[model samples]
Target: MASNKFKIILWSVGILMLIFLGFFLYQLTQSESVNSIMILLMLLLGLILGGVIAFLASKKLVSEPAVITESSHTIAESMRKVFKVVSAEGHFNEIYNYEETTKLFNFIPSKKKALVIVQAKVLVGYDFEKFKWEVDEQNRKVKLLNFPAPEILSTETDYKYYNIEEQFFNLFSKDDLAKVQQNGKQQVIEAAKKSHLPEVAAEQMRTLLTELLAGKNFLLENPAKISETKNLIDYRNMNNSR
Candidate 1:
């Protein structure tokens, strides 16, 4: 909007300058004693004023500040409407080696081994149901008393069997294949976790909340650790102390 307004101002200024130049030419024709220096000076003044207007037009419209009049509950409710916020996507190529252990006194190695190449897409996101927060208009902040940790929201996996060596005595069964599939999925999840997917997702969420509260000029703060098992401690007293 601001850019469009500035563009309009620039075109208007250009047209006005052209008109002024045409008028100066007409004055040149009308009077031989007309001071060309004075006319140029006047045009310079007009250009300066036009530049000022253009600069003002390019500025942000501060008349309507983002003042969040809605209650914290309302904001939270609106956020819930967003449901599962998938912030990052990770494509993983993992090799999961699945083997059945020869459990002879728990000291035997599995002679049967199958190399499973797993290609998976992992979605990293937040569960808003676990989101705990409070909007403190006092501090101009939406304090995430309990910011939900990024988790593997979903994992889609495709497995390709590479080297399948099964002993005649301990052959692969349905249960073994199931274990392989599960392990392959787990490998993809682990790979996603080990990558920067969670960090990227967290940064994205922070950016999102920051923009959402930009109108209010509010900060997004996560004081409590989402990895902790305990509930977010009542932070009102803490904030009060601060």
Candidate 2:
């Protein structure tokens, strides 16, 4: 906003300067005084030099540092939208086999046995609702305050049970199979986390921000500079050590 105001003032001054120069040139052209044409030419040359100086002065003023504050709320909201914009997924499968046998009575008994197989996948990356950032407009830079670490966002599983032999005393219920499916889904999520799928998503976000801000003349400040801080911080807290 200040930049816009500065430009308006500069251009206003420039236009007035040009108008005065034009008026003087007109009057000189009508003059019958000695060396009138020569004087007019010199005035035109002086006007060119003055105009150049004025343009440079305006540029210098515009470039001067001004405090531009961007709130955490604004950045966080925008980043949240972009966070859900694209998501990364990790695929995994685990072969889980379980056998359980149940016998009834001491000497005469029928046995119940079953075989199970499970496959699962995990979704990893930003959820968008949890986003945080800080901006320093004066420096034309932004800092990622807090971001979701690599984690399993969601999981899907498929399972099959076969080769079952059950007696009246022993049975496998739907509840039992449901428990196995849930376990399989959890295992897949843990595996995905260990594989650093979330880290891959984080890198993607970094690239996204870099590209997003490039045209805006904004830079993403390095995260390593404040590696110690676990949350978002004010721009003043940043140090030169980075």
Candidate 3:
């Protein structure tokens, strides 16, 4: 907006200068006694005034003051630290079982069965290490420009195998236990994601930024250009689907 206003002023001044020049030229042609030196002096005055206007416009709208730049850098540096903005804990329990049997040439078959009880706890939140932002010095506002989507930060699983009912036929292998634990962790993560953890984390971050900037005499712009976590989640899902 500031730039647009500056452009308008620049064009208006240019057009006014052209009109003044044209009038001066016409007057010089019509009056033989019109002093050439006076006309040059008037044009120089107009040029100097126009230059001043241009300089003021550029200074006010095009360039950021050093103090503003310093403030922005200070905020950026402070935000570089990792923030565990919000966390959601999820508990998941799943049953893992498989059966196998061997068949002989004609008839008799032996079967095996194995089962495991798997449980896990998952933690999900935003790591502010990837958070991004910009300072709108012209507007005296701090803007959250971009940030990483919420994700499952960590998963811890505890699982145990049930005693085999038929040891000869169904036995749990090391790979089977590993797969069960992994599946439990994945389920917990998915459950946590479905909750409102991301939105909570975003709101926490917004509050933190507001407080931080307030101390520096800067105001945080609400409904930041692209910082809302709800929108971010939708965007991330859309991108992943693609």
Instruction: Give the per-residue Cα lDDT of candidate 3 at 231.
Output: 34
Each prediction's TM-score versus the true structure = 0.52, 0.50, 0.48
Q: Pick the candidate with the highest lDDT.
A: 1
Which residue window of length 10 is worst by lDDT in model 2? 233-242
lDDT of 3 by residue, 1-242 (tens): 87888778888978888887878878777766647767767787878887787878777787565653333333433434355544444566767665657665546676666576767665555666676777887777776667666665555667776855554444557785565556555555555566665566556556667788889888877555324454333223221210
On TM-score, the candidate that comes out on top is 1
- Writing each residue's lDDT as its tens digit, candidate 2 over 129-159 gives 5657789999999887766544344566677
Q: Give the TM-score of candidate 2.
A: 0.50
- Computed on alpha carbons, the lDDT of every model, listed in order, comes to 0.70, 0.61, 0.63
- Global local distance difference test of model 2: 0.61
Write the candidate numbers in order of decreasing lDDT: 1, 3, 2
RMSD in angstroms, candidate 2? 32.5
What would the TM-score be for candidate 1 when compared with the true structure? 0.52
Model 1 ranges off by over 4 Å = 1-82, 101-110, 137-140, 215-242
Cα lDDT over the full model 3:
0.63
